[model samples]
Target: MLLSIIYVIGITAEAMTGALSAGRKNMDWFGVMLVASATAIGGGSVRDIILGNYPLTWVQHPEFLLITCVAGIFTTWVAKWVVKFKGVFIRLDALGLAAFSIIGCQKGISMGLHPGICIVAAIITGVFGGLLRDLICRQAPLVLHQELYASVSLVVAGLYLGLLHFGVSDVIATVSTLIIGYLLRMASVRFKWRLPTFTLNMEGSVH
Candidate 1:
């Protein structure tokens, strides 16, 4: 639950960043708000649907939508002043990634799944929402890039699993995972560490 709040806050920050960017580029206020709301919640909605968790967070707590909209308005209004510190968006995004990864893993564990499944599910939960946002923006997903993106989530998930095995409380495991994932993502970006692109040919056919 704490992780969920962190996830919401992280996405909210991203939404604001996206809104400000759009507004700076001369997008109308409505367009800016729409883009912000979409970026903030689109991924989680899809994740809930896929996981068969009916009545997603936004649906159950309609305030999620209301909050997102209000945040969009606030971002649009203040974007001109806030655009100077663009680097902050990266930090917020990393924090969000870590929070969501822990929440995802914890959610899976609560559902009584196997450890491996829980870890994989956690990684997906952390990433799927951002993936949706990128798809809508017509950009490649972060994990699909050569960056050490998904790897950070995977590592966090592994760490969370280890913590659980050692009988750590969910809160402890989650907080630790969030920190690890956030730091890993930040370090990867700062150091320009990334995964290698792979190419394979099968029987003269490129796949």
Candidate 2:
């Protein structure tokens, strides 16, 4: 129940941020809702598909879809305020990322998946929504280039698994992962921490 509540909050925040992205592009209302829904649910959908978990969240609970659409329209009205409080959204996104990773890891564990596959599930849940949003908006995918985005997902998933391995209660593990993951994400953003980029120069001598 706690996880479900947090998931709702996560998707709401993600949808609002996605709406802001749509507003930046001067999209129509339909476009706003489309992007918002995609950003809010795309990751979970991908995770479920990969895990062969039928009846995705939005499919099972249509209200969640409604929530994202409403959040998107709400953001359109408060677009300026949303921009002004971008820092708050960043924090919310970080929290959401942690929650998503934990949820994904839990799903994989429930399915008796390998630890590595669980970590990959976490990464998918934490990263792909933003990827979809950026693709729809024609912006560069932030997960590919941003500060420790996917890395944070991996770390949080590993930490959650480690805590479980040590016999920690689920509640404790979830809370600890959330706190640490959020802090790590914020710190990465503040310090401009980034993964090394791989650039291939085909400039002079490739046949």
Candidate 3:
């Protein structure tokens, strides 16, 4: 049930971000919907494919696609009016990250994955959707930036993994991770806190 709610919120936020970007780029309705759909399901689709899950989640449960479509349309219609308040978008994105990261870590642990791999998977799951969204919109991926964005996912996933390692209940671990992730993200944005970027005096490769 918690996972379901998180999925809905994540999908809706993805649609909203895609819609906002599309409007800013002057994309047509079709292009907007494409971006919205991609942002909404790109991560989960990739994860399912990696896990060798056939038919994918949205494919097996087509209602998810319908929900994404409706959210895309709704965001497309309202984006212009709310464009000035981009902070709302950021907050929604952070919340989505917190929710999805916890869910991903839980799923990974349930599937008997290693704690380290589960943490990695959780970070990927949280960031991949937004990364694709930005890429499709011709912007830099959020995870590639010198921000506390992906760090939030890693921190939350690490906490969850630690708890699970100690044999904590799944619900408690998931909720604790989600709350900490969300709070940290909100505080980071509010205080403009970010992970420091590494710089080399040699000015060599950028990787």
Candidate 4:
């Protein structure tokens, strides 16, 4: 139940940020809602599809979809305020990322997946929504270039699994992962910590 509540909050925060992105592009209301829904639920949908889990979350709980749509529209009305408080959104996004990672790890464990696969699930849940959002908005995917975003997800998932392996209670493991993950994400943002980039320098190679 706690995880479910956090998941709702995470999706809602993600949807609001997605709406801001849509507003930046001057999208219509439909576009805002579309992007919002994609950013809010695309990751979980992708995870379920990859795992062959039937009856997706939004399909099972239409109300969650409705919440995203409503949150998107609500963001439109508070565009200026949202922009003004962008830092708050960043913090919320970090928290949401941690929550999503924990939830994804839990799901993978429940499915008896390998630990590495569970980490991948966490990465998908934490990162793919933003990827979908950027794709829909025609913006560069932040997860590919941002500061420790996907890395944080990987660490959180691995830590959660490790805690379970060592006999930690589920609740304690989850809370610990969430706190550590959130702090790592925020610190990365603050410190501009980033993975090394790969660049190709080809000179007149194409015919």
Candidate 1 residue lDDT tens string, 58-114: 798887777777787888667766677667877888898777667677767777878
Cα error, candidate 2, residue 200 (Å): 2.1
Query: Can you write out model 2's per-residue Cα lDDT over 1-207, one digit (the tens) per residue?
Result: 777888999999999999988998999999999999999999999999989999997999999999999999999988889889989889999999999999999989999999999999999999999999999999999899989999999999999999999999999999999999999999999999999999998889868
> How do the residues 56-114 of candidate 3 rate in per-residue lDDT, one tens digit apiece?
77898888777777777787767766577787777877788888788777767767887
Candidate 1, TM-score vs. the true structure?
0.82
- Candidate 1 or 2, higher lDDT? 2
Task: Give the least accurate 10-residue stretch of model 3, judged by summed lDDT.
Answer: 44-53
How do the predictions measure up, each by TM-score?
0.82, 0.96, 0.87, 0.96
Off by over 4 Å in 4: 204-207
Judge candidate 3 against the unseen true structure and give its global Cα lDDT, from 0 to 1: 0.78
lDDT of 2: 0.94
* Model 3 CA deviation exceeding 4 Å by range: 199-207
In model 3, residue pairs whose N, Cα or C atoms come closer than 3 Å (at least 3 residues apart or on different chains), thus clashing, are none
**TM-score: which is higher, 1 or 2?**
2
Best by lDDT: 2
User: Residue 165, candidate 2: how far off, in angstroms?
Assistant: 1.1
lDDT for each residue of candidate 4 in 96-187, tens digit (9 for 90 to 100): 99999988888798899999999999999999999999999999998999799999999999999999999999999988988999999999
At residue 26, candidate 3 shows an lDDT of 85
lDDT of each: 0.74, 0.94, 0.78, 0.92
